[model samples]
Target: LTVSVVVAAKRENITHHQHANVGDLSSAHGFHTTTSTSYYVTFLVESGDRIELCVSGTEYGMLVEGDTGRLTFQGTRYLSFERI
Candidate 1:
């Protein structure tokens, strides 16, 4: 899937940095994406910085199955972000 993390000093700002696409979910955890599929974005910011999560693509396939190899196409998804 494709995602972006935009940060700016004001709400009117639209500047952003495009990151690479994330790969498939991990086999160990059917609901979680691979650990290596994370993005590390670094930029200058102040105390009142504004960050946004923007998505513009399909996160799953047409016929995704469950861990048991059954036809289960509905589940939960998550995203994680950490400041260094």
Candidate 2:
């Protein structure tokens, strides 16, 4: 599905976690760290409705705030965006 929209905003979320490595009992190797990043975009549709969708990192990079485009999505999943 596609909708004509204006890019309202963009945001990124990052998370980190520490895990204990039980096998390697040494203090230096006792723990490991992991990081995760997520991206989201908000759009203003022709009907004056606002919708926010989670997008991929690459997709996030291509989107610019205030730009008008056609947003393609499936259900709540973001597919692609094309500038008008």
Candidate 3:
């Protein structure tokens, strides 16, 4: 997955980073599957900094015969900030 730290309103991308294959298949049933993953970025910033987390993926192809289906992602995602 690709990650970026962007400044709100300005829409300026401060950093462009990527983590390849940063996910796992936790469970699967029929054409449905469950995935879990985590990511973190260590950067210096000020308080009230508006950072956005954007995640996107691309589909290569499918295996089922003559079956065309689209993939949907829906889950709970949260981000916590801390100083170190």
Output the worst ten-in-a-row residue range by lDDT, candidate 1: 63-72
Candidate 2 lDDT over residue span 1-84, tens digit each:
899999999999999988778677565677888999999999999999998999989989988999998998898889889999
Candidate with best TM-score: 2
Q: What's the C-alpha lDDT at position 59 in model 2? A: 88
Which of 2 and 3 is the better model by lDDT? 2
By lDDT, who's the top model here?
A: 2
Off by over 4 Å in 3: 1-29, 45-84
Q: What is candidate 3's CA lDDT for residue 21? A: 37
Give the higher-TM-score candidate: 1 or 3.
Answer: 3
Task: Assess each prediction's global lDDT (C-alpha) against the native.
Answer: 0.26, 0.91, 0.27
Per-residue accuracy of model 1 over 1-84 as CA lDDT, tens digit each = 222222221112233443344453443423422332322222122433322332112322121122111111112222432222
Order of the predicted models by lDDT, top scorer first: 2, 3, 1
* Residue 16 accuracy (lDDT) in model 3: 41
Select the stronger candidate by TM-score from 1 and 2.
Answer: 2
Clash-forming residue pairs, model 1: none
